[model samples]
Target: MNIQLRFFASVREKLGMSEQKAVLPPDIKTVGDVRLWLISRGDVWAEVLAPGRALRMACNQQMCEPDTLISEGAEIAFFPPVTGG
Candidate 1:
């Protein structure tokens, strides 16, 4: 499936890119799958999207869990957790 991936805040800085269009393998079906797929890309990707890492995710602008189902043209975003004091 084809989708748009977005990175924000420290995640963008760490990854060195903010967004990209991606064509996922048929085995990737959920947000968690995408995260795992990306983690396999290399060390940097693994560090940023690691399973135990603290991050926030969203699908089409609405916050979603790892199990969220994705679709063609869907937008998935990753970012660090935010805090305002």
Candidate 2:
């Protein structure tokens, strides 16, 4: 499936790219699977998207959980939790 990936805040700074297009393998079915798939790329992908990290996700511009089902041409975004000082 073809999906769009977006990173924000420190996640973007850490990954060095704000957005990109991805072609996922058939095994990747959910937003969580997408994270694991990206981590498989190693290097920065692994660090920035490591398991156990506190991250927020969204699908198609709406906040979503990692278990959310994804589809072809979905837009997935990752970022830290919103905070205020």
lDDT of each: 0.96, 0.95
Error of 1 at 75 (Å): 0.2
Write the residue-wise lDDT of candidate 1 on 4-85 in tens digits.
Answer: 9999999999999999999999999999999999999988999999999999999999999999999999999999999999
> Model 1: which residue pairs collide?
none
Model 2: residues >4 Å from true position, as ranges?
none
Q: Which ten residues in a row have the lowest lDDT in candidate 2?
A: 45-54
lDDT of 2 by residue, 1-85 (tens): 9999999999999999999999999999999999999999999989989988899999999999889999999999999989999
TM-score result, candidate 2 = 0.95
Worst 10 residues of 1 by lDDT: 42-51
- What would you estimate as the lDDT of candidate 2? 0.95
State the displacement of the C-alpha of residue 30, model 2, in Å, after optimal TM-score superposition.
Answer: 0.2
Model 1 alpha-carbon miss at residue 11, Å: 0.3
